[model samples]
Target chain A: MTDKPATPRRRGAARTEELLQVTLDLAVEVGYAGLSIEAVARRAGVGKHTIYRRWSSMAELLLDALSRAWTSDLDYRDTGDVRADLREQFLRSAPALSSPPIGPVYRAVIAEAQSDAALRATLHERFLVTVEQRTLERITLAQSTGELVDGVDLEFAAEVLCGTLYYRALLTDRPIDEAAVDGLLEMFMAAYGAAG
Target chain B: MTDKPATPRRRGAARTEELLQVTLDLAVEVGYAGLSIEAVARRAGVGKHTIYRRWSSMAELLLDALSRAWTSDLDYRDTGDVRADLREQFLRSAPALSSPPIGPVYRAVIAEAQSDAALRATLHERFLVTVEQRTLERITLAQSTGELVDGVDLEFAAEVLCGTLYYRALLTDRPIDEAAVDGLLEMFMAAYGAAG
Candidate 1:
């Protein structure tokens, strides 16, 4: 292999990845309230301007870090049984949401968003909206197949599904365990399951 | 009108009320992040020790303030119709949750709880548990009256009911409006309503 200097584009991309990684590490350790660009720059051995140039605020930077690190499969696998599909998806993703790197950081952003409307909008547009829309699509498909009830407002159904898990995860000390998932599904099915 | 100095007990009680009131006012103005015992004392024209003698932490003091100002009737009005009762309660309390004083301050405290486990537990024990339990009681009564489905785990039902409203209130900008409330109740009724 020829030993040559990396291109500016390659160097910039590498730096960006490094910054994001460092941000994730710091978020898990100190949480959102303790995180700042200055701290990230110090940890990454870069100037604050480097981070500011890429992201306007700490929330934006943290959002990118979370989005990059969020590797869980968000899409549902249609197992022909809509209930089974939802159960599988939640069982897979709930742990990631309640655990490190993503969990604490995401909670911090949500907390900060209570005060910052712009961040709230960004979070909804970027993360929550995607999750909600995916849920709606899955349930809509189920409705079409006659697996779910017809002529009902499925958007509210979607919100309840996603929102309940988030509530258990973010607000309460309750576990997003199998029991919780099953209970939620039971209610959903009872409400939306088509007449046999 | 008191022509003489108030008794020590009376004065202490008055001071406590003043401190809690000041705490609520400050919480609404600056949010939990901007709040401190020092700021509350300064604003209330009292020493920090005066505020500290009664409450142990800012969160505790804030909790007291919230409890004091929380005037909404948490109990459901047994209208015999379970859906109507729930709808009435949600419509009544949702405005308090989304509006000034309570809304912003409560959001800030919830946000702070993400980082602090003690605060989280306190919030759960003090506020969420009460709401959840009351909902359980209401639904349990309905179940007994042949309104709700029997033999189902109603605790989970309670969580979903309260949790969805909270999810909408705190996480998303979606208004907890009549349609939203009605949609949620429709699902609940569909799931839990006793088979005719």
Candidate 2:
């Protein structure tokens, strides 16, 4: 009649997710350097052991939080319009990278990674490289369907587009707003998009 | 004829140049946050007053060092070869932003500027915006002379090219080396190069 007991795996996963959210939140409040394991545990109402058991160091915890924060699992439309699809894809990730909570946490992590090699490796592998791969795949798909031009340099186009947005997100006061996105989309489209 | 007595203005200018070189060296040795006016004065064999007189704070000192470090008053060739000129322009700045002393100093300032607002604004104004303006001017010149195609987004092209390099310099282990520069030059040329 009643609900079944939760599995150990489910309990462990739920706790981990809760801890990640806590870390991400703390990243905003205290930033990267001040975000200690002890502080995260206190904020999450979990024992220190709960977090340490999952992450051996604050660096590892920061990387996990960053992976989640920068993740962009976009549901891009095939409106047969490369420009619109590109805009949609960019907007999907821009909010995660520019809005509060996640954005500040990401900025703190990026700033920290400048001096931390192991952390930079994790960021390069998990976020920068991963995002580039996903974007390249989308560009390749666009090419196959004739949305993008044939024989275009896939890596160059993808990196430049994403790099532009990351430029603004990390360094500039200008957010990649709708207008900026449109400009980016148009620039990229002129470079790679198929003609009408 | 006896040499004219060294005017105070000439003596002060020489001392300022020596101080800037000292600070740039300290940036390589101790990094941005660790650099101090005292150390710069000690290394340059000048009084701390020499540096403090020029820059009121370490942040201002850092910006001055960065501006001098990155500036390249290149006499670019209009050799009717886009790739060659592109390579030359990129290589000119790459050494400054990638080599010892200046390169490390620039990296240190960039890392320091990430969390520092006043420093960031100084960097954004003195180096980033200035460099972009010069680059945009060159692109405009190319367009006018029929090197690059007409109606290409000049700002977008310039920013993407430089932004790609900045991304590597600030965030990753990969240096903006020859091959990387080649890829970038090709990308820009493909999108905007005027046909023969």
Interface RMSD of each: 1.0, 2.1
Among these predictions, the greatest TM-score belongs to 2
Residue-level lDDT tens digits of model 2 in A63-182: 787777666444456776667777888887788765676766676777777666677776776567767777787788889999888986888677777777787666665667897777
Please give the distance, in angstroms, between residue B132's alpha carbon in candidate 2 and its true position after superposition: 2.8
TM-score of each: 0.80, 0.84
Candidate 2 lDDT at A115 equals 62
Query: What is the C-alpha lDDT profile of model 1 across B149-168, one tens digit per residue?
Result: 88998999999999999988
- Candidate 1 residue runs with Cα over 4 Å from true position: A1-61, B1-22, B34-56
**Per-residue lDDT of B68-179 in model 2, one digit per residue for the tens?**
7666543455676656876788777766666676666665666666666667677776667777777787778889888888976788677777777777666556667787
DockQ of 2: 0.46
Error of 2 at B26 (Å): 2.9
Cα lDDT listed for each candidate: 0.87, 0.75
lDDT (Cα, tens digit) per residue for candidate 1, span A1-196 = 4778888899999999999999999988997889999999999999999999899988878887887787455789887799999999999888887577687789889888887778887777667877888889999999999999889999989999999998888777778899999999999998999978
| Candidate 2 chain B, run of 10 with poorest lDDT | B69-78
Q: What global local distance difference test value does model 1 have?
A: 0.87
